[model samples]
Target: MDASFVIHGPSIKPGTEIELISNTDVAPTAAQLLSVEMKNVDGRVLTKVMM
Candidate 1:
């Protein structure tokens, strides 16, 4: 399966393209954007997507 998307916003880094990422990372990334820190998260934040 191939999943793709486009994220465009002030917070998203321009022309960012991460070749490796986990489905589990979605929640952590969202939490970070909401300024909420999760404890012992199963996945890490996709910081490469951020500016």
Candidate 2:
């Protein structure tokens, strides 16, 4: 998630699904924090982050 997309006010519960739409490339550091592999819609590996 981008810095701008971070919600600072409340705690989000588990199982909550948030949709993120970004046109700009998400930094490698950010992808690592999210623990989700950054890839294109076609399943191409853009970056691999540890889960």
Candidate 3:
């Protein structure tokens, strides 16, 4: 499968790009954005995109 992610908003920097990410990361990233913690996960939040 081909996977790509894009984010656009005031909190996100313009023209940011991520080379790769796993499917499991999507949920964790969303949780981070909501300021919620995720437990018992095999993946982690992709903080690079937020910067």
- Per-prediction TM-score, please? 0.78, 0.23, 0.79
Residue range 1-51, candidate 2, lDDT tens digits? 454443221233333444553534345335545566666542222222222
List residue ranges in candidate 2 displaced over 4 A: 1-26, 39-51
lDDT for each candidate structure:
0.82, 0.39, 0.80
Q: Which candidate would rank higher by TM-score, 1 or 3?
A: 3
Q: How big is the positional error of residue 14 in model 1, measured in Å on the Cα after superposition? A: 1.6
The full ranking of all candidates by TM-score, starting with the best, is: 3, 1, 2
Can you tell me which runs of candidate 1 are displaced by over 4 Å?
A: none
Model 3 local distance difference test score: 0.80
User: Is candidate 1 or 2 superior in lDDT?
Assistant: 1
True-structure lDDT of candidate 1 = 0.82
Give candidate 3 misplaced runs (Cα > 4 Å).
none
